[model samples]
Target: MDQLTQIIAVLGVFLYWLILGAVATRIVIKRRSIGVSFSWLLIIYFLPFVGVFAYMLFGELHLGKARSSRSKAMYEPYGKWFSTLYSHNSHQPDKQSDYAASISKLCDSQLNIPSLTSNELELQHTPEQILHAIINDINHAKTTINMEFYIWHPGGLADEVAKALISAANRGVKVNLLLDAAGSRQFFKSEWPKAMKKSDINVVQALIVSPIRMFFRRMDLRLHRKIVVIDNHIGYTGSMNLVDPKYFKQGDGVGEWIDMMVRITGPVVPVINTVSAWDWEVETNERLLPAFPDKAQCTDTSSLVQAIPSGPGMPEEVIHQVLLQSLYQAQKKIVITTPYFVPSEQLLDALVTASLRGVEVNIIIPRRNDSTMVKWASSSFFSELLAANVNIYQFNDGLLHTKSVLIDDEHCLIGTVNMDMRSLWLNFELTLAVDDIKFATKLKGLLQTYMDNSDRLSHDEWQKRPMYRRVIEQVFYLFSPLL
Candidate 1:
């Protein structure tokens, strides 16, 4: 009995040491941020078995070697197409402005999108307005309609848009639809996709996560971009998902969601089309020609718009860079609204630094969040921001789902990216950078409306929170890096 026990003990020690070595090797090999690597290291060291399993599922950003290679491969064709069509632009006089030059140069060098002038943009605030406008645009589609969303629940406006897409497809307009598998998992498994397929509308699921594929591809990396292009003339993007605001989920307490989207027309349309094409090619391996190769000249507007697409496939974080630069450029004021605010250390520091430099920085978030963990993690930053003289507002009207940034009265960014780690590092996101006084003024007005309905959170109020809640929030904050 003693001999057998000794042999089992030896085997157990060897296995434990092997697991430690394996976990350490994986964390080091991934080349993650030091803070993130250290966090995972600590987890693996303390909770050996559970950490090993969690690391296998979510620790490493292994989005599949084959998929990563294919994403890179598809970019070449996207580059060629963008270069060819964008080179012939005759109405790019606004690109020479200093305000446009700084941001344009940054994005051009990093994201391959030039600062484009001659674009008309309209901001839609309510879900009803946004959905109606989208369906109308779909009904007016002449040649093609391309749509992509993170969450595409079928009902209400989604059903209306579905019927419109079906009608457009029957009329010989090539309709293409793409939705993230994890975001729209139930929809992907429903009969809606099959019905759309039968109607000749090409549909593709982005970054599918399945039991079999989970062992190969990273299931955590999702496609969170929201894009829509109609006949290469009209495009829409923002935080608005395809589901109704009233019935987004089974939740009962939270009221209607307040979301926003931007409708664009001009040279920027083709640029947005290129983003959709790149995603389509990456998932379906089918190159999509521009619905309208030749863009219409629009000298009626002075807005210089650029569509910046950022994701794991890219060599750099394009939107994150823009956000940081915009914060530094803020001289008068900065107003931001997002559903999630679990920002990276760099982003949080930028906001604090900007406020310290005498810029008025206001951050608006929902009063009640969809994720309790995210809400607590977000609240932990309030004390630091309040000390920096940054105004923090929690929306009381409803769930403020708009992801937007307005810097001063001339620079603005509206899109699907939230102020969170997952948006900045893990998921694919898109943003529209607009440099126009008129548009920025309107955006500022809209933000003012939100402020009028929000309750400003004071540092004093934050300190009065119960001890247990504070402890829970701080604990969640420690895991913000992973969040």
Candidate 2:
């Protein structure tokens, strides 16, 4: 062969071996599922040079030290607080003793989280209500305020919230704000309010991305948490980002953004505040402790709540395991509402098994997804679920961003966890696991609202799509393991 042809052959051979080595390394190091491993192998084999680069850049899984430090810092305070609360609360016998013990077992087994007493959880629906609650809480803050969100824009309601934060800071409340670099790129590009700095408010960006750093980090792994902790006593978290009506406003006659938020007080607020502090410490080299006076005296009479935080840095997929276990334990019903519905194989099996065992399994997903590929991949799962007797509903009114799970009308999970591989393994996510019948009932009511507006997909309806669309879904499904 001529020199050029020999050179080309040698380069191709080198690329092939490199990819093989990378795949083998990932399997050994990450210990990912067979599907994920095989999917990586296929990507490298079929896509050649581009695939190799993508794998090198985005495929190498590393549970880095930063995540570990953040998790440790976040959980240490909770551990201390929980140890004290459990000793005090577990000794006294009450009506919620069994529920508290169950919560303790769940924390120890599933999330390794410590259970605390003296926390109140109030479920709030609608953006307007949540916003009003947040503003009211901030206005009453005496010591400090911490706000962290994936998105922060200066317009409409967001602008008003920003003004509220500034006002709180000006009123001697120490305000610390953190926004995800990837999600709030616009806020960073344009100078944020200079008055924030003037008012002694600290603002930091989480996971800043640069052109050079993009080669190593997948920008998709976002800090997709929305938390606002005030006075280390009151907290808020859910699907709502700190944006305005423009985001939800139906341009071209679409629909409004429907979401949910939970206002939490008592012991869980400190946990949420600790997580915010951990995130702030990771971004800026400053450690923050609770600034407010101790006011975590048990206020509510019923229900138990545990705050669970999971991310790539964690040893296990705690949130995913929790969901799977809940599904297995679900006897009557499993109701889930998420904007995205691309679940992993294990999760799919759990849902399918539950459905086959006569559990009323229902999932509500958005009819119009922001991500096209994810929508296709999600749609592909309908056939299998339909076959297994699982009910599926598409929210046709607007985009559904609520992430919640109601299991058997006895337990509920609410927070940032979405039923997707990204949420399960990559993102730093938080969810409040509640063992309250009332909370579960409230969650069921919220799910029912979506179900009322949504259109149920029958097997016939799903199978009636065009052949090309089916092919597209199948193609997307083939890569679902990767997604």
Candidate 3:
């Protein structure tokens, strides 16, 4: 070889070992769970060049330094204000049931979110109903309307809602709209955003992800929350996105999507507003005030809500811990409904343990999932769950998009959180820990409807599945940490 070729060969050999050493060190020291680390190491060894870059782009939980400093600075004042407001309106923990009180306490202790008691909550069951209610609220909105959603299509009933938003903006209502860059990518590209901006509405596309941005932060970390607040008095949240099911994901061939949303009017609305402000600040670098002061405090024994926001900023898996605790505390029944069910081993064990303890455990998942990987990964765990006598149902009607967990008939957690590791550990999720028998009863009725359209999995039948199919499921489950 020539002089230059010899030098290049030596440098390449040295750099290869250096890169391998550095990656191995980072992966080991980070201790990002054994499964995640193993997956990365496997890819690194097998893919070599592809794996090093992949790990660098999507490995760590880091979210860049500038965003970190901004989040830190923003949390201090928000924490103080939340403490002061929560002290006055929070429901006494002693009054709630053991599990309900524990979950509420966990939310307050971790995120300083208080359990609000004076709220009027209405559950919107259908997509059209949710859109109509939001549009009606926008028409009546006098001061401000804030909306944050993971998905917002610019067609169908969603477009009618957009018209309402534009009309509200035209009427001098301050409309602040924030949509996720990934989920609402098409919405941002559509003329609807341009029209809204032209109408002087504050429109923000949150977490504008890019391949170049991956070097600084985990590119897959998503702002998966769905929130809406009108005049700081009325708020809406749940699994429902701002898209009409008719116009959303139609090609998936999973039938029409089904979802649930809750409309709130009372003390809890401000808390939802506060989190929305935090998200806006994170994306726009513009500071906004906490939830506006509302005097509509109804200290009643009816509707109680504690908003729990979980994501990368948090030190622990707040929702995951809450789920485990709730599972352990179940006295009579447990119900969970989600479109995706790929979960960590701990969650699987918890469900199995609950069933082994004779707690009536019913898990509802979609039969015809939009993603085949999600379907197989979710199915891989059914053998263990079924063996433990945990009842599993596949909702054949459509994609059951409601993410909710009901414990007995007293506590219910409803929001955009899925049972998968993505929602449990990565995505910015919003879940309402509701402690009301009335709401739980209503949710139970809704869940029964889902079960009515579902087929129960038989343990014997599941064991008789084709060997190749079972192997495919195991293959998908191997990457559960990533999924």
Candidate 4:
């Protein structure tokens, strides 16, 4: 009995050292952020076996080699499409200062999509307004209607849109719908897909999650883009999902979500559709041909727009790079509205330095959040931000779910990229970069409305929180890198 006990103890020690050696090597080779590396090191050293399992599951990007190769091949045709499109259009003049212009150019280079001119953009604020615009566009579709969303709940908003899509498909319109397998799981559990199939609408699930499929890809990577293309002439993209804002989830304590969407017309529609097409192709294993815009319908609009898509399959962190560049170029003010605020160290540093350099840095988040852990983790950075003169606002009306940024009234970025680690590193997100004064001014007005509905957090008040709350928040903040 004594010899057996000694042998088991020796094996346990050997396993512990093996896990420690493997984790240490991974941290060094992955070259992740300092915070993330240190956090993993601490967790692995402290915990016995659970930390190693968590690292294997969540600490790495595992989109599989075959999937990654296919994604690269998919971009080849998209590159050619952009090349031809950019050659025909006359380049718009740089209306921005040198700094802002450089930021715009950086996005263009990173996204491989030019800042397209001659596009008209309309901002829709309320859920009713956004759903109405989408349904109206779908009803008028002549050629094709392509829809993709992270969540498509089977409520009134989704049912109304589904009805319109079914009607369109019945009229010989090629209708394609793509929903994230995980996000729309509830919808699929109903008869909505059956109804769509009965109407002959093509439906595909993106990033389907299953126990067997877990061997091929990471379950954390999700398609979070909300996009809709109608007739190859009109498009919609923003933070609004198909679910009703008033009832986002089962027990959303916050009030109805205040979200926004942009209805687009002109040349940028095709560019936006190209992304939807690529997503569909990736999921369905079928190439969707890019829709061509009618020459007669294209006019001389002035808005310069670029679509930036980021995900695990991509080699570069495109949105992260573009956002950092925009922040660095902020001359007057930086106003950001996001539901989540757990930012990367690089992004947090950029906001801090911008505020210290006399730039008005403002961030608006919800007073009531769906995730308690996220809310606590987000508050942990308030001390540093407030010390740097960065003003923080807690939206009192409801959840301020819009993910948008306005920099010096010269650049406006809107879409589904939240200011959190999940949106930055795990999920696939799409953002629109608009460099037009007219649109920026209008967006600024919308942001001011949010400010009117929020209460600014004072530095002293933030620091005076209870001792236990601060300790708990700091503990949650330690897990922000993995959030």
Candidate 5:
């Protein structure tokens, strides 16, 4: 055969083997029960080089062994203490019926947070408030400080925070900073300050991209968790990233970013610490033992808080299951606020089913989302929800990043989990389940503020949107599960 014919034959054989390898890999990965493998396989097959590149660079899962081991070791000492506290405080025989019984039942596990009996919770609304609380907590840290965020810029408020962390580290407090490699790619590339390097501050990036896996994964998976644990006593978790206005600022326009952060002092802190340790260990390969809080010498004022962490590493998708359960258990009302609203089919059905059952179900989303595709996907659900008598509200003022769920004024969950496939399946997310009547009432008040400012969509109005827009939304919805 001529040289040209031999080249053609070689190419044909390579393509055949590639196709076979892809098919076999998909079957084996699916049988092994790896999460989202099928969706990834479809991406790889359809997009070929690009799909494989993205997956290798971004899709490989890291379980944070070092952090998990450290957390297990640290918690071992206080495991008994937590168990005793949970057992003793959980038996609320004298509890009075305050809200809807159905709501109580839906949040029974969240309501019985063992550390809330003596701890106090302060809800910080604005960016300034959150920044101040974080600074104050870092300032007050005596023993150790753990901080993790998806985004950490080097200037503005982030600069201030970096300085604070450096000062804390200089003061002999052990400081560990965990940042998402994708989120803070710029920060990692830029120069590091001498003070930050000299201080015993350990910084590690989650999910570092490797040259070999560059073709298979790139951006589909991320850490997406924001947490701050100080002295193993105080904890902070929310949808906020450690970046400033310039990062998200629209050209010549003020970038408005809205987020809700909660500061909890109770047994929940230890859990938050464990999550941090887990992430740290995954990035640095150093085991972190749990650091138990010193016994309180004074009365604690925080409410009951349970820090529930969920991700692919867990045995099940606890956050998704809990939200679905809450939706099913709703009798009077179901309120949800999330920046990303691309939910699974099951979640969509639950919401529609609840609304059909005469329950008042409402969802709050931003009028203009940062992500064009996600915005289109979210809009795709509007028609179906409106037809089912579900109220849809779009925040007109700013980007709504808060992930909140309020059910019948009795059960409320607020934290880092978004109503999207990533939060449910890929990212390590944290949420606080609050069953306190007072806390729920306060959260409801916050929801009301957003609702007041939001523009509610009527069925007729949603249906009246342009045909082209509707088509785009529908197309996006078809792939929402993979998003």
Candidate 6:
């Protein structure tokens, strides 16, 4: 019996090795990023069972075959609509600098988002200001109010937003609200959606999840964009979610989150609205394209703005390529503010190479992150970033929830995209490329404010971190592609 047990154990080990070999072959055949493929290999190499489950759960970027088919069906129409929307604005000359023109051209060609000119933009900061502005727009919404957000915590000012939406719906305004199933799980459990529905507002959830359905979809693929279009004229998008800082995540020891939102008014509003419409149509199979601004309406503009939307079915590396271009294009200074900072090798290399070539690269992240894995993984990249003179500062006041990249004094990249892999590669994100000098100046000053309250990391000091912490960071770094 003892001999039989030993032989069975050896067979079990051999079977495990065989399974791993099969998984490795599949991963390499998939041809994911080198880091991602290797990370999965490491995860499987160590915790054989957990790694296999994790890879099964997250290894692929399949949002689902259903979504893929729907996307392919709509791809042609969506691209044509976007092109027509921009063509109407051709009367307005492309008054962008060479730098902005190149970046905008990349967005047009790669992301299929054409740039519009002459749009008015107001950069709103703080929860109080953003909520008030959005609520005011909701209150005044005459025809329609469309909103989508990742998280919508039910309390404080967010309740007020709910109230505003309710009131708007009661007043016969066609209101539509879209929330992510995972991020806004708490909101779904709350009474806000119910109350809004009572007022006849169309409240739909994106990327719905369940125990059984998890096998069919990548449950982690999130709709991370915050977008609102009021009356198909006023548009808002930024890092601010539907959560009020005062009531959300208070006990986490990371103070209230600091965020920013932009109030946009011009032809670009339609672009933003159309993006929301595409999302609504995709999730519900109900087309809201007609509700978007017409080609004639797209003619009026005040500033150069290009709306770039990226996600699972979209170009995987559109935003990543744009950021690389921005970094490479930066001749003077580059300031970036984001909550998460687990960047890919190309992103890290871009920053390092930019700094080496005499461009000042400043990155401001929160001192205390909400995710332990993100914190350690972010720190692990610091060794290379710091050595290359890329200045990294941890914001001390609160989680710097604003995701922004200000290049020189002429171009600005803002919206829901983060400096993390999930955002770059998986999540549905919306980004606005502004070729306006005024907006860039405002964003620059705002980032400077963040830097003022941040603590800079020194290369020597960072290298001197305790061995255990460094070890933890490296361990986390190995799984950054998973983060």
Q: Which model scores highest in lDDT?
A: 6
Model 6 TM-score is: 0.95
lDDT of each: 0.84, 0.77, 0.86, 0.84, 0.72, 0.87
lDDT of 1: 0.84
Better of 2 and 4 by lDDT: 4
TM-score of each: 0.95, 0.91, 0.96, 0.95, 0.84, 0.95
All candidates in order of lDDT, best leading = 6, 3, 4, 1, 2, 5
Across residues 1-483, which tens digit of lDDT does each residue of candidate 4 receive? 999999999999998898789888988789888888888887787776888866776678877666677778877787888666656453454544565467557766766566667788999998888898888888889989998999998887768888899999999999999999999998889888999999889988888899877767788888999999988889999998887765467467788778999999877888889888878877776888675655423254567777787786554678888888889989899999999999999999999999999999999999999888899999999999999989999999888899999999878899999999889888888899887788889999999999988999999988899999899988988888877
* Model 2 pairs in collision: 118-298
lDDT of 3: 0.86
Count of clashes in candidate 1: 0
Candidate 6 on 1-483: residue-level lDDT in tens?
A: 999999999999999888888988999998878998888899888987888777778888877877788888888888888777655643243577787787777877886777777578899998999999999999999999999999999899999999999999999999999999999999999988788888999999999989887898887989999999999889999999998999999999999999999998877888888888888877888878744354433323355777889997787789988888888899989999889999988899899999999999999999999998899999899999998999999899988899999988779899999999999988999988888776787888888889999999998888788999989988999999878
Residue-wise C-alpha lDDT for candidate 2, range 1-483, written one tens digit per residue: 699999999998987787678665765577787777777777777886777777776675443456546656656664564455444442232544454456557667655556655656677777778887888888888988889988786666676677788888888998988989888876666545566787888888887777766665665677888999888778999888887646544463546677888887666677778777767766675778554325345544545677788765554678887787778878889999998888988999999999999999999998887778889999889999999989999999778889998888878888998898888888878888777777777878878989999999998887788999989998888777767
State, as a TM-score between 0 and 1, how close model 4 is to the true structure: 0.95
| Clash count per candidate | 0, 1, 0, 0, 25, 5
Best by TM-score: 3
Off by over 4 Å in 5: 2-117, 191-194, 213-219, 252-254, 293-302
CA lDDT, candidate 2, residue 442: 80
Model 3 misplaced stretches (Cα beyond 4 Å): 2-11, 291-301
User: Local error of candidate 2 at 254, Å?
Assistant: 5.5
Which portions of model 2 show Cα errors greater than 4 Å?
1-12, 63-85, 88-103, 109-111, 248-254, 291-301
Query: Candidate 2 local accuracy as lDDT?
Result: 0.77
Candidate 1 segments exceeding 4 Å error: 25-31, 90-97, 250-252, 291-300
Cα error of candidate 3 at position 77, Å: 0.9
Alpha-carbon deviation at 117 in model 2, angstroms: 3.9
